[model samples]
Target: CLGDRAAVALSRAGHFRGRTLFSGMLYAPLVMPEVITGLSLLLLFVAISAERGFWTVVVAHTTLTMCFVAVVVQSRLHALDRSIEEAAMDLGCSPVAAFLRATVPLIWPAIAAGWMLAFALSLDDLVIASFTTGPGSTTLPIRIYSEVRLGVKPEINAICTLIIAAVTVLIVVASLAAKLSKTQADNAAPM
Candidate 1:
């Protein structure tokens, strides 16, 4: 969340050397191979002497997810109207207050989409989790892979189908809710 917000702030700033540098660094992770990311994370844990476990997996996934969120939010920020934030500040709102009251509410759909993308990526991740996970810290993807190695089971297909359906339903519901709220707000607005 912080990364996404920071990306928006930085991207909104006028073009500069530092912004260019930050954008390069931010997008670099997206192009990096999963194997390299996994290996690098494993090394970092080993170097720090941090115990590899659930938290480590969580950290690794969060790192990966942040990059994705940053991308989504940046694009949204680019298409946003800067005048709204300026108007808020001109109307006596502080810079921080302007962000919270004007910017955030308008860009909420993008933030939500980014969050959902991050969640789905984390859920489907296997390569990074494999490197970061300790014994007994297996994820669903890992478990499914292991099961596939033994033999493909019909029940596994059913479970995968159910998971896909659940995710699809969640996405549909969220979209419908967002649309309903927008319609309500529009109806309540004065001409």
Candidate 2:
């Protein structure tokens, strides 16, 4: 939520500050290894004298995933036609009102997609979570890794299978939702 809102607000601000700096930050996480991101975030936490706990893990995950969300949202924004918002404004809506009413509906699918991506990344993340998480904050990926370190068992396989099935269902649902949104957007367009 924060990532999408921040990206759109920055993009709306102007060219240089928005396009260059935010774009660079977003791509930096993509290129950097997960270990490096984890280490850097750990260092940041240490510097701030913050305790490693659930909220710390949440913050670290958000920081790492927001860049990905920003990139996805930004690409969608770029592909979005500005003319729609302009037409809304011409119809007597304020700029903010036009963006909220005319623009948001069109790009909502992309936002949802980015949010889901961020969520999935956070879900399976072990490296970063290891560096940032404290006792009692163990995530599913960490648990799976631990189980894998022991010999893989039938129960583990069953659990893995269930996770795969869940992820598959999520993907199918998201795809259908995106397609529905696209159809609605098409229907709403002026002839």
Candidate 3:
């Protein structure tokens, strides 16, 4: 929800003043090193006297991934026809309603893509997770790394295999869905 709203706001930033600065701040994470990002988050948490745990990790991952999601959704938004939203607004819809009804449907695929990307990044993230995580909140990647330090085990191999299989299935399903959506759209178009 936060990522989607940020993407929308950033996408519409060009219409407002200070677009460059706003865009730069949002996109900074994309170019910043993961270690630096993690360190900064850790420092912030410490400064705020916030306990590092699952929630902190969640926040860290969200901060890291939100920019990526924004980039993906922003690209789709840029490619989208503004007139569809404008037409909705012209026909008595409020601006927010026009965006929700007209723009969101068109950008649904991008939103899904962004979600998938964020999930994948969070799942495998070790550095940021390490910095933000505390006792009783170990993530899969952190656990895997710790297990590997003692030596490669069959259980670890099996877990890795399962992760690979799951990711492969997700990719295949997403591709088929995209193909089906495209076919349906093509068929629905006027001759």
Candidate 4:
């Protein structure tokens, strides 16, 4: 939700001053080293006296992944025909209503893709999670790393297999859903 809103704002930012500067700042995390990003987040948390825990980890991951999501969504938005949304508005729909009813459906695929990307990044993230996580908030990657230091175990292999299986299932489901949605839309269209 946050990422989509950011993408919309940034995509429309071309009409505003300082667009280039704002865009560069927003996308800077893509090129910045993970260590640097993690460190900066840690410093920010400390400065604000925020406890390093699950919520902090969530915030950290969101901060890191939102830009990627924005990029994906912005690309889809760029490819989208604005006339469809405009037409909805022309037919007495408020701008917000038009965006929700017309624009959102058209961009749903990109939103889903962005969400998957963000989930994957958060799932495997180590550095940022490490920096932000505290007691009782150990993430899967951090736990795996700690366990591996003592020696690899059969449980580790099992866990890895489960993770792989889960990801594969998620991908298959997403693709199937997309295909089903497309089919439904096709069938619903007028001849």
RMSD of 4: 2.0
User: Which stretches of model 3 miss by more than 4 angstroms?
Assistant: 13-19
Clashes of each: 0, 0, 0, 0
CA displacement after TM-score superposition, residue 11 of candidate 2 (Å): 2.9
Error of 2 at 20 (Å): 4.2
Winner on lDDT (2 vs 4) = 4
For residues 28-114, write the lDDT of model 3, one tens digit per residue.
Answer: 889999999999999999999999999999999999899889989989998998999999999999999999999998999899989
The window of 10 residues in a row where model 1 has the poorest summed lDDT is 2-11
Root-mean-square deviation of candidate 3: 1.7
Question: How close is every model to the real structure, measured as TM-score?
Answer: 0.86, 0.84, 0.92, 0.90
Off by over 4 Å in 4: 178-191
- Rank all candidate structures by their TM-score, best first, as comma-separated numbers: 3, 4, 1, 2
Give the alpha carbon lDDT tens digit for every residue of 1-191 in model 2. 87787679666767664567666776687888999999999999999998888888998898889888887887788889999999999999999999999988988878988988999899889999999988777878887888889989888899889989999998898789879988999999999
Return the lDDT, model 2, position 162: 96
lDDT of 4 at 47: 100
Model 1 C-alpha lDDT per residue in residues 5-69, reported as the tens digit of each score = 66775777677667777777667669998889899999999999999999999988987888889
